[model samples]
Target: MIEGRVWKYGDDVNTDVIFPGKYTYQPLEPAEMAEHAMENLDSSFAKEVKKGDVIVAGYNFGCGSSREQAATCLKAAGIAAVIAKSFSRIFFRNAINNGLPVIELEDGVDDMEKGDTVSIDFEAGTVTHKGNAYHFPALPKEVLAILNDGGLIPHVRKQLGRE
Candidate 1:
């Protein structure tokens, strides 16, 4: 079970808004990048986000650019998961590769408001918020494996027992 307060956002929240391009040349680490997470959209996001806080957004979330830092920043910012109506294809892959679960729901965020306490059961593919339950197709075993081991790197590490 994953539980957290909802931090709602709108559609087409691009990678640039997520981490900004000015800092891209700096090669800042995840922690450094996290300090700027959502700074453009919400300046206080990085400092205010508590561990396990959930991010809910509208369709086409994570659109624009294919930078992996977008996902890295969110994970480093301690986001529990991102439940959106849709996501850019590369962003979706980057998120899963970096250990952040991105869930798609057609109307899930419509009923959610900022700061709504939400709970998700990946095994059951159910999301509960404000007494409303949203269900999705069960996550595949491979996806679960990557998430369970904390992204692809750790999952691969556990598989080989070493690099």
Candidate 2:
């Protein structure tokens, strides 16, 4: 179960607002990037987010530049998963490749409000909040394999008996 205080955002929450373009020149360190995550949008996000917290957004979350930092920062920031109405193709793949679980909810994240305690059952593809159950498409086993092992590299290492 993935549970935390819900951080709600509207549609088209792009990467620039996510990681910010001003810091694009900086080193691609997860910690550094995380410190600036949502700085361009929600000023207190980086400082306030808790481990296992879920990012609930509208359509096309991560809809800007295809920088992998956008995904890595969120992962490093301790976001358990990103549940959105839709995601940009590249962002979605980057997130999966980096071990950040991203969920696409057709019904939108309307039932939950910011600061509301929310929980998601990834295996069951259901989100529960205040007795409300929101269903999302179940992630494929292959995708879960990567996330389970904490991203692709670790999973590959495990498969090859190297880690």
Error of 1 at 40 (Å): 1.7
**Per-model CA lDDT versus the true structure:** 0.90, 0.87
TM-scores of the candidates are: 0.93, 0.91
**Which predicted model would earn the best lDDT?**
1
Instruction: Give the local distance difference test score of model 2.
Output: 0.87
Name the 10 consecutive residues with the lowest summed lDDT in model 2: 105-114
lDDT of 1 at 101: 93
Residue 67 in model 2: lDDT: 84
lDDT tens readout by residue for model 2, 58-146:
88999989988899999999998888999999899889889998999957487667898888887788988888788887778888888
Clashing pairs in 1: none
Relative to the true structure, candidate 2 reaches a TM of: 0.91
Q: Kindly report which residue stretches of model 2 are placed more than 4 angstroms away from their true locations once superposed.
A: none
